[model samples]
Target chain A: MTRFALTIEFDGGPFMGLQRQDHGPSVQQAVEDAALAITGEQVILHSAGRTDSGVHALAMRSHFDLEKLFDPFRLMEGLNAKLRPDPVAVTACEVVADDWHARFSCVGRRYRYLIRNRRAPLTLTRGREWLVTRPLDAKAMHRAAQHLVGHHDFTTFRSAHCQAADPVKSLDRLDVRREGEMVIVEADARSFLHHQVRSMVGTLAMVGLGRWREEQVAQALAARDRQQLGHNAPPDGLYFLAAIYPDD
Target chain B: MTRFALTIEFDGGPFMGLQRQDHGPSVQQAVEDAALAITGEQVILHSAGRTDSGVHALAMRSHFDLEKLFDPFRLMEGLNAKLRPDPVAVTACEVVADDWHARFSCVGRRYRYLIRNRRAPLTLTRGREWLVTRPLDAKAMHRAAQHLVGHHDFTTFRSAHCQAADPVKSLDRLDVRREGEMVIVEADARSFLHHQVRSMVGTLAMVGLGRWREEQVAQALAARDRQQLGHNAPPDGLYFLAAIYPDD
Candidate 1:
């Protein structure tokens, strides 16, 4: 068996999620369908991140096993042609070892969340970005986010349906910066619980609004209770920016 | 009568064009309907630029005369709210003299066109940007554009459907620059003949592709015939960036 690793970019607005669903279109289904069309074989793809509906991915990595030896570049071209109008693209394809797993082999994941902190309604990027008419202080949000970095029990930021065995996770980096009328937040972690990034961003927004102090975030993480966090930031602004793999 | 000048921004993907048509939605109809819905008075709006279908506008200025005095800011807010979920936006509004016209009073018009030159398919900005899979040499294109940036009869670059009385027009600036995988072309002029910018870009693309030399563009302009030019660039990448008005 030959394992093929693929780097992909997708607009998740039309997808139900990365996972296969019974009723709606999904990124997994789209890729699997394209792979079947290209190789004439059914394959299950393992993704580094299972993004939710309305989320986007710039460089989401996935891997699949096939019995035939096929050119990786040709696979990318064929998959792209079959994907059609769906906004999903196979950007890069490479042959990997049979032991390689897109999810388990990933050492870290990077995500970017965008907030248009202005009064003007979004005309060009309405569904692609989160529009927060309220003014946000990026400095305040950045200062607040620093307290939550490093190893912590992230139960307060985890989703109720999160399937992780433990609430403890290590957040390697969290940075918030402003560009023009937009506020961008970058987060890096080995792995994350469901909705963890959104919850953290939601709490940071309170700091931006001057409603919560920077120390509040540290205290909430220590509490490890889900009730302490703010609302979940919408999926529109959340993007799976990249995934890091261990160098052999 | 109160003459109100409004700044507009819209994603023109769904509309026929800026001008009203008998079959499809137009930017003019969208704005006019919004104005009438707010003020209960029928008014005519004049725009600085008449953009084609699938073209976008960043700050297209327009003026309309109303029978009643409505707070310009309030009117903008009302129109934006009543525009429903459409991509049209009334960004700003101010009262002006009755004689002020959006197109005739404009001293200069600025337009920006974007082209994403890369092998990868566009996922995030599909309709907002033009995608070119082939590599383009921005330096060559820029150098070639200098030959046409002065007072000249631009018959080679003007569309046959243009209604302008004279083809001789002075170009203030024509700049081409590359930012990452995106190539941006900015042009400023008192006015432009129909499809002038698109035609110039088409010929410049040939220069970028090594199909035509830099001197060929000058000869094409001197030919002063529409057949001398290259293909018309698509409207997807064109933007009515802004309009400059002389101080009263």
Candidate 2:
């Protein structure tokens, strides 16, 4: 058996998310079907992050085991060809040890949220970006974001449907910046509670809108209640940027 | 009669360009209909540049005359509300002299083109960007662009069906820059021929791909023949960035 790692990119708009579901299409199912078409074999693929519906991934790495010997790069090319019409691509493929797991072997994950802050409706990025009609204060959002960086119980930010065993996790970084009419929020952590990033962004938007202060974020964190947090920013604005590993 | 100068923004994916055409829906028609919906009168609108279909506009300035004393700002808001689901917006409106014309009064026009140079098939920006699979040398493209920056007949870069009376036009600036996997080409001029920018980009792309040399661009221009140029690029990646005019 050979274990192979693949770097993937996908537009999650039409997908139910990274994982396969009974009702609709998924990124994983699309890739698996493509692989089946190329190799005529059924296999389960493991991803570094399980992104929700409407989320996008610039580079999401995954791994799977195949029972036969095949050229790694050719497999990737073949899989991509079969995956056409679906907004998903397998960019890289490399042979790895069987011990390597895409999810367990990962050290951290990075996410980016893009907000088109303008009056005009996004035509090209309609389903890909979050549009905010009101101008946001990036400085205030940045100040409020600092309160969430570090080890803490993120109960207020966690989704009620979150399956994480614990709410306490270390957030290594959370930065918010604005470029022209775009508001960008970048976050990195070893792991995250379900909907944590979206929840935080929704709350930070209130701060950016001058409806909430920086200290309010701290109060929400201490509340340990999901109801204390702001709305969930749409999944459209979120992207699973990358997953970091210990070695190349 | 009162002349109203308005700044517009639109997603050019659905229309045949900025100009009204006999066949398809146009940005001009959409805006004009929106205006007519609010004022209950027929009005003629003029634009700085007549962009082609699939091109976007960040700021396209235009003007229309109205006999009704409707508040220009309020009318803009009303028109925007009426143009919903079409991805058009009237961002700013002000009263101007009756002689003001959206097209004739413009001193310069700025345009931006986006080329996504990556191996992955575009997932998010399918209709919004030009996806070039070949390796593009932006430096070579930038160096070659300088040859067409100054005053030139630009016959090679103009469309065969262009209705311009004269081919001689001064190009104020032409810049090619790289941002991540995207190549950006920015151009500014008093005006342009029908398909000039798209034609130039198509030729520059040939240079970037090593199919054409830097000197080839000059030779094509000096040839003073439309057949000497490369193919006309699609309108997907183009943008009407802004139209500059002197203050009242």
Candidate 3:
């Protein structure tokens, strides 16, 4: 069987999540079903990251194997055509070495979270951005975010539902900045515990809102207790930006 | 009576247009209805520019008058609360001079058109941006757009339904730039004839695609004939970015 890697972009609002689920539809099920219709092959899609419902992705990498070989461009076109009416697009597709895996081969991952700091109700970007009515001190949020940049036992930020065996992980970067009414937070790491990013963002927001002091973020991390978590940001504003590979 | 000026932002995907229509719903109708419900009096909402069906607004300026006066802050918050689930927001509201008019007092209007030039189907920004599946040379498009700037008779670009008495209007700027996979066209003018920006952009796109020479834009303007127009772009990508007033 030939292995193919696909880069996809999707609006996760209508999806149950990125992974296939028995509960409802997912991005993986949508693409796998589309592949079945095109190539008459039932395939399992393995993505680099498993996103929760209501989370978006700009370029999430995934891989699958097919018994029949097809040109990457034609395959991409056919997949996109078959995935119609669904808010999902296969932006890039290519053949990969049999040993290259979409998830296991990846070296790093990136995510971006957006907050619209305003009192006005959202209109244009309703499901795409989180609307926060309170004024956010982005500089304070940025300073607080620095406390989570290095390696740590992030038990305070890990979700109770996380399936990862270890609570300790290395966080490469976490930066916050404000642009007009938007407060943007960008994070990078080799891998993250489920809900870690959201948990961290929610805690840092307390600092921006002047509720939690800057050093409190460090204290929360050291406590390493889920109940000690400040807050957990909604999935509405989070986006799986990209997945990094060794050769890429 | 007290006059109030409002700055609004709306997603036009659900509305027939910005103006009130007998056959369908509109942003103006939504705001007017909200105002009537709030003040128990019918008030007409006048906007700086009349947008076509499926056109969005980032900061459209509008005004309305009411016999019963309410605090500007209270009025704005109430309107936002009443306009729920309609994708319209009163971003700002303030008391204005009785002589001030939303349409007449505006000194300039700004518009932005976005085109996603890619083969992939749109997911997140379906109605918010136009999808064009052709490779466009933005530099050529920009050069061609320059031909339509300055004072000119724009009969070729004006829609047949245009009610403007004269087709001659001074266009201050028409710029075309490429931002990654998107081609953005920004137009600034004292006023524009119906369908002027879309018509000009459609004609300029031909030059970008190598179908029409750069001089064709100038020749089309000189002809001043509707039949000479190359194309008319769709309304999905057009946005009333902002209304410019001389005072501030």
Candidate 4:
């Protein structure tokens, strides 16, 4: 048996999520179907970070085992060819040790939230950015985001449907900055609670809009109650940037 | 009559072109239909630059006349609301002088062609960029591009169906640069013959890929023959960036 790791990018607009689902199409299902057609083997792919519907991925890492002998490069090329008409691409593929797990061995994760702060309705950039008509102050949002850094109980920022075993986690970084009319929020951590990034970004947007004070984010985190959450941003603007391994 | 100037943006994937066509929908038709619905008067729309099918626009300048009096801001908001489900937006609008003309009064035009240099097939940027699997040397392309940045007879680059009165025109600027995996070619001129920008970009790409020598572009220009053109790039990556008026 051979284990292979794959790096991929996908547009999540047409997908239910990264995981396979009985009710709808998914990125995982698309790849699995392609593999079935190419290798005649039903392989279950495991991804480093699980994403929600309407969330894009720039470079999501995944792995699967194949009992049949094949070249990794051929498999990657074949997958890309077979995954036609779907918005998914296998960027890099390599043979890995049997013990190397895409999810378990991952050491860190990164995410970015994009807000198009403009009066114009989105044309070409629709579904890729959250449009905020009201002007936002990025510096204020950055100041508020700093309060969510470091280890803390993130219940106030978690989704009610989150399946994580614990709410306490260490957030390595949370930074906000503006480029032209775009307001971007970047976060890094070993892991995250479901909807954590969106919740934090939504709350920070209030600070950016002068609806909440900068110190209010810290207060919400200390509350450790889901009901105290300020806001939950839509999934359209969130992007899973990368999965970090020890070697990377 | 009230003359209103508009700065609009659009994704040209669904339209035939910016001009009103006999067989297909157009950006001009969309705006005209919306304006007629709002004011109960037939209106004709004119734009600064003419775009081909599958070409997008960033901030295209246009104008139209209406006998009914209306505030510019309200008209903008109404047009945006009326042009729903279509990938078009009016970013800015204001009243213009009676003699102002969208096409004739324009002093300059800018265009950018995007080439995504990567092995993987695009997902999010599929229609917005041209994907080139081979590595491209943008500096080499830029060096070749400098060969076309002045007054010259551009007959080799002009399309056979071109309607321009003169084949010789001044190209104020032709520059190429790379941002990460995107190779961008930006062109500025008072006017361009049909297919000139795409033709020049395609020739420059040959130099970037090492398929043609650095001086080959200059030779192609001097040949003044359409058959001597290296390549005619597709309209997918071309963008109408903006129209430059005297004040802008």
TM-score each candidate.
0.95, 0.96, 0.99, 0.97
- Give the clashing pairs for model 2: none
Error of 3 at A122 (Å): 0.9
Query: What are the per-residue Cα lDDT tens digits for candidate 1 across A55-171?
Result: 899999999988898998888889999998889988889999888899999999999999988755788888788888788999999999999899999999999989999999999
Better of 2 and 3 by lDDT: 3
Q: Identify the leading candidate in terms of DockQ.
A: 3
* lDDT tens digits, residue span B1-248, model 3: 99999999999989989999988999999999899878798999999999988889999999999999799999999899989989999999999999999899999999999999999999989998888888999999999999989999999999999999999999999999999999999999999999998899889888989999999999999999999999999998999999988787
Predicted candidate 2 versus true structure: per-residue lDDT over A1-248, tens digit per residue: 89999999999999999999998999999999988888888989999999999999989999988888889978987987889899998878999989989999999999999998976566656778899988899989999999999999999999888998999999999999999989999999998899999999999999998888889999999999999997789999999999998886
* Candidate 1, position A142, lDDT: 96
Please, what is the whole-model Cα lDDT of each candidate in the order they appear? 0.90, 0.90, 0.94, 0.93
TM-score of chain B of each: 0.98, 0.97, 0.99, 0.98
Sorted by TM-score (best first), the order is: 3, 4, 2, 1
Question: Over the stretch A67-157, how does candidate 3's per-residue lDDT look in tens digits?
Answer: 9989999999999999999999999999999999999999999999999999999998989998999999999999999999998999999
lDDT of 4 by residue, B1-248 (tens): 99999998999999998999999999999999999989898999999998988999999999999998999988998999889888999999999998888899999999999999988889988889888889999999999999999999999999999999989989999999999989999999999899999999999999999999989999999999999999988888999998988866
State the local distance difference test value for candidate 2.
Answer: 0.90
* Top candidate, metric lDDT: 3
How would you encode candidate 4's per-residue C-alpha lDDT over A1-248 as one tens digit per residue? 89999998999999999999889999999999999999999999999999999999999999999999989889998999999889999999999999999999999999999999987789998999899989999999998999999999999999999999999999999999999989999999999999999999999999999999999889999999988888898888999999999987
What TM-score does prediction 3 earn?
0.99
Model 2 per-residue lDDT tens digits across residues B35-113:
8999987888899989888889988999988888988768887988888889888878999888778899899999999
Indicate the fraction of true inter-chain contacts that candidate 3 also forms: 0.90
DockQ of structure 3: 0.93
What's the candidate order when arranged by decreasing lDDT? Answer: 3, 4, 1, 2
